[model samples]
Target: MKFLGALDDVSLGRTQRCNRRLTDPNRLQAIRDTGLMDTPREEAFDRLAHLAAELLHVPLTIISLVDANKQFFKADFGLPSPFSETRELPIDASLCRYTLEGESIISSNALADPFLKFHPSTGPWGIVAIIVLPLINPEGHVLGTFCCIEPKVREWTAQELKVMRELTASIMTEINLRNQITKLKTEQNLRDTFVAALTHDLRTPLTASKLSLQLLGRRHPDMPSVQTSVARVNQSLDRAERMIQNLLDASQIQAGKHVALKLSECDLHAITVQTLEELTAVYTDRFVLKAEGTFQLMADPIGLRRIVENLASNAAKYGAPGTPIEVVLGRSGAQVTLQVKNQGNPILGEDLKNIFEPFHRSRSATESAEKGWGLGLPLVRGFAEAHGGRASVTSSAEEGTCFTITLPLDARARAQTRLELLTSDRVAPASDVSVSTRE
Candidate 1:
């Protein structure tokens, strides 16, 4: 074995040039994409590093990735107490940088080699020999290095280098497989969330429609309220259809698709008034509408109506029984604010934060007589945002609960921004109603 001088012996200009060449932007990005840096030491990787040390007859081995600023050890074997506790080292001090520059670097005599002798590991740690093999991905990017270190100078043989290269390939395969599994699990979670929301929300309206039809069947053909029963059945069917549409829109949003809107000059006041009137017909007079200032905006009438309907319905179901639900529509500056206030048990702090998330129902809500799938608030937020606006809620013991939506006078311009913010993790407040449609 021939000894080489330390890495620090290299001239400043040459070292800077080498550093620049090693930090390829695309190569660095590929390293990040592997999702391997700073990960917990896995037994699979540990076994490979152990095998390298054993086969090469060396005291230390490391499976490391050279990040932009640091060389991170994914697995390490045969290191002293304080060094074993270390997870990373600065890039400039890393011998692995040589392997990352695109080939295996082997030095049997570090104290005599110019670059190797000056390296921190060689000088202070007394590492006399080292062999580093690049862990190259299928795309031909050098992600990191697998290396063996010796405290005493030793001869480097062909078989030892071959074994280390083979182990590097195995390490890369495991990393790629782990990343794929992580991605698949993420996608599966999204699908499960969508399914849960759909199944739960559909049940509410379906049960209402079924009960209405059963009541109509028991009534005589000459019954005076026969027409009223038919109306109630129609309302249930309509609600069910709306629920399906909202779910579809939510899916579209998740898929990075836009929520289609029919924009036109519409009377916000009329929409609120009509929505409240419909609720009165179904649930008696538990809702009150208070309008101040002009409530006209360029918006999708149906979307606006759905937003109000969901909020009002949520207030009725969750508010204190016999307490009035207030629907307030007012204008501030160029924005119109629609607030649904209900007096009941205030939402818990944690639950309030996640209320608008799809398929999320607070403990209080789930315990109530009226059960829901937890999509109402999410849909309300989706519709509100689709109109280039935002929906928020405030709840406390003294103030009860209030869900407020503020929309721009012209929503078309901000439509794209709204779509971008509707992520799966977001939760919003919602409303509900039953045949007595009264809470």
Candidate 2:
């Protein structure tokens, strides 16, 4: 065992220079990209630290990363009291910084070295020796260090150094594999949600169209009633096509793709009225429309129509039977507000928090005989947000339930703002719906 007194006579200036020199911009970025700093300890990382400490006959071992100002322990074994509890130390107080300067480090007697004797861990934690190896990614960036610490003066053999290097490779492999698995699971969940929503939405319209066709086959071709059935079938087919498009948009959103808007100056009031008429044809006099102020806006006509249709349909389906659903479109100052109100069972307090989250169905929806994939409200919110607006809901026994969307009169500006927000976050938006009955 050769005693190499490395870091001897290291001055304050030299330590400062070493800290600056070890701070690699690309390497620090790579560390941040791993998303592992200060994270909760995982068994995979803890297992490697445990093995290193036991195999090397050391009292402590740590899997640590160097950040801008501090060293964070992803995992550690045999560290005492506050140091172990905090799992971090200032960079200047840590020996882990030395590993970043080279591929590996071996300090046979840290306390005997001039500069290392002043280290916080050496004096207070009684760390007499250390063997550290850098954890490097395939991109050739040093993410952090894997180290074994001793409370007594000791020397590391050539064989021990080789073993430590092998373990370092294993630690990096575990981190990379864990991140890859997490990503795959997230993508799988998104695919399952999309498929479930698509199946449920498509089934309803397809069933309606199929039934309408069967009814038409039995009707006299010359009868006026035959024309009505034909029109109903056509409407169902159109609705099915729109639903297919919505599913495609959902996929694009999940893949971090932007929703393309067909912008035009349009009468929101007129669109609401037409949507109401269509609802009446399907559900009869179950809904009432209230329009006030100038309901004109620059927006995507198709997207706006989809938003109204979804909100109204949700109200009709969930609201108490015989109670009229109310649709209100109003303009105030620079914003246009659309409200869809219905009377039904009040949403649970816990459920209200995540009501707009994608694929989140309320207790009522889950227990009811009606089957749905819980995509309508999410799509409604998506369309509203794409226009640089927002959708929200309030439900109580006294007020029933109301879903409101507030949009800018000119959505082009809103769209640009929304794009900027999306770019900054790099995450897809979520949406929700609810209804309540009077006591």
Candidate 3:
């Protein structure tokens, strides 16, 4: 009926108006610039929404941010669009606004509510019922709303409301964390910008000094000691710059800034070949990447390369030089693992636990003299976790240390692509394909 269509228009208008207010001509740029959703956070929010949908027995569930002008879906399931404009309704007409108006729950039997009478979203979609639960932080701020829509008209019981409340509580916790991270990132960006400017200022003098030293070196080729001194000064400046960048990286991690993966379905052999080609310049000795099949993995080439680089670099620095550093990729069913092994003084029993922590140096590590702020392994752990996986290290004096990271492929996406293989050929179901191998 026209009711459903009218509601769609109303929602769209409300969303657009909210967007305009939150992102006014000048403020719009800043609002758009603040990218609040990253992969991990998005996954967590989706899980929460799933739980809400299950509890409410609704076909659709949405965790949406209702700003002054627009309704932004942070996560949604069973909905055509994860996002849509709602600029048609004023703030007073919003179910989310009702939550702020001291209502614990906003439910509507769509057929009976005059407010939704013109909103055609209900009848056409067979959605006769709806509810919106406010996701409020402990500080009494409404972050968003967890909404449920059903095709059938049903009564919500106290127990169901309680379950929704619990789910929304978890949603609030996640939002609060996101807010804290947002504030931290705002501060960190400011810090990074200031540091970059300051460093630039300092670098000008260092560059001038280096240039003047080069002139001195040419003028006095007989005095090698003066050249050595200039070289040392140059080295110190370079080290300072590296340290600053490291600090920036640490801040990014703390701010929960993630490097988005440009993933492709590429065979392990190709990835290994590419990794080896890049590693040849730094690790010309014995570097091996062995794998069995042409199994494909969805991975960001750059991020994966960084992970391999860090592990290989660590092995070269701490492990015995000229010894073999082995890289192996293996798959088991739905999981894939990458491991790096080297011969070195194995991790002591005590050091294994804290090795992945930031700024932690292993007591048994022989290369303390090799410069590092102890952020590498922690950074590795963050990258692994970001991909819904983990990084682990095991070592013994006899066998040396082996660092392993296990990552899960995007199963749903893979299922979509591999359905043909499963249906046409006598191939193992994607769920049943397991190849277990270890180093």
Candidate 4:
């Protein structure tokens, strides 16, 4: 509890000098790995700052992380203007950096202290007494401080010092916890990237086989046996190719990235009917279309095809044998609606919770040993959203299960607007290193 036993000369582990150690490359990397520096203040850190300020009865409290040349405020309770907007101060202006030499500091008289008497905090900033607990990680690197400042000098209370130490421990936990999460996410992204690349490479050979099968059937019109074998091979290849694309699309969208689209003026009715007909090759005469309209709109034809294929395919897997899977498409206002419903066992309430989540399959579905449908719903949802549309589902014992989608009549405008927004956010100036992270 007496971490404030000494407030003088220090050896900085390896960097030899205090200022040099403040800018140590390894410490800077550790700070970056935490990602608290230069990022927008989060409520979790802000609440900690407020709690410390209130408990310690101090006018100002900052959860500061020292960087190479400045101290960045992860959260602050009473930081004054200019500094409040900037969220950072040069290393010379940072009393927090002095704490990074590896000890907590409690300066009872800032006006008399060599370091505090020179900083603006003791001058026009009006802060006199200060208590700073160095935020050290498990690696024993002092990242920064949980600082409390007072306008008037006050006696140091053991209770207040204990509370500060405890809260700083909590702050260190949060920093390391967040850093671990970021590292895990980075690992997940790397894995997803590998899956995407593998699936993509797989499709190249699948495509060649498909084309070769097409030429084989075309050239041997008189041979029925050859044609039948060629047809079956082509079908298997098509299914394999579709599965590969599903894996690729699921991988991309799971990482919060969109599936690339080739948008154009496409016939929704035609896409739906064509996809259903192709699906009939496997599901047989089970799909029933329930609309009569031209339903044309600006969309990605291939994307539209996948939407119908995934939904109908999903319906077939879950629907009772010989039951008709219903597909309905229509337009209202400047929006288009497409629905695929099936008469099947009502989806369990628990399964409905994450039914559309990528790679998720219900327990019942898993029990059936069905394949390919694993990523269908997510692809259905992702393709729907990529076109500025939304996909949803409802299931009931009496009403059956229905999946619905709504899309803008012209996705071009919505897609363009989104692209502009994403691009504009990325155009942060080089000198403003934090702006991109803030966005």
Estimate the Cα RMSD of every predicted model relative to the unseen true structure: 15.4, 14.6, 14.3, 8.5
- Model 4 per-residue lDDT tens digits across residues 1-439: 0121233443223223456668778888888888777899799899999999999888899998898788898899999999999999887666677666686768788777655565554567676788889888888888988988898878779898889899988998888898888887888779887996898789889989889888999999999999999989987997798788788878777777677676777789988889999889889989889876568777778889998988898889877778988899878889989999898778887799899998888876887757645688898888888788999999988989999999987777666765665568763222211111111
- The best candidate by lDDT is 4
* Off by more than 4 A, model 3: 1-247, 364-367, 411-439
- Write one digit per residue (lDDT tens) for candidate 2, span 1-439: 0112344444554555546646678878878878899899989899989998888888889899887788899999997778788989887676777656554666888776675666665667677787878887777776789988887878889888888888998999987886687777688678858766777777786777777686775676777777776876777677777767667666555554556676778889999889888888777898888887777778888889989998998888777877999998888899999999999898768788777666678998888877776777877888888787899999998899999999988877766665566667765452111112222
lDDT of 2: 0.78
TM-score of each: 0.53, 0.55, 0.41, 0.70
How much lDDT does each candidate structure score? 0.77, 0.78, 0.64, 0.80
The ten-residue window of minimal lDDT in model 1 covers 429-438
Which sections of candidate 4 miss by over 4 Å?
Answer: 1-32, 35-130, 138-142, 148-153, 157-185, 211-221, 427-439
Of 1 and 4, the candidate ranking higher by TM-score: 4
Model 3 worst lDDT run, 10 consecutive residues = 430-439
Compared with the true structure, model 2 gives a TM-score of 0.55
Model 2 clashes, total count: 4
Error of 1 at 402 (Å): 0.9
Ten-residue region with minimum lDDT total, candidate 2: 430-439
| Native RMSD of candidate 2 (Å) | 14.6
Report the lDDT of model 3 for residue 286: 74
The Cα RMSD of model 4 versus the native structure comes to 8.5
Encode model 3's per-residue lDDT on 166-195: one tens digit a residue. 887787766667667788767877976875
Candidate 1: segments with Cα more than 4 A from true spot? 1-128, 131-229, 253-258, 416-439
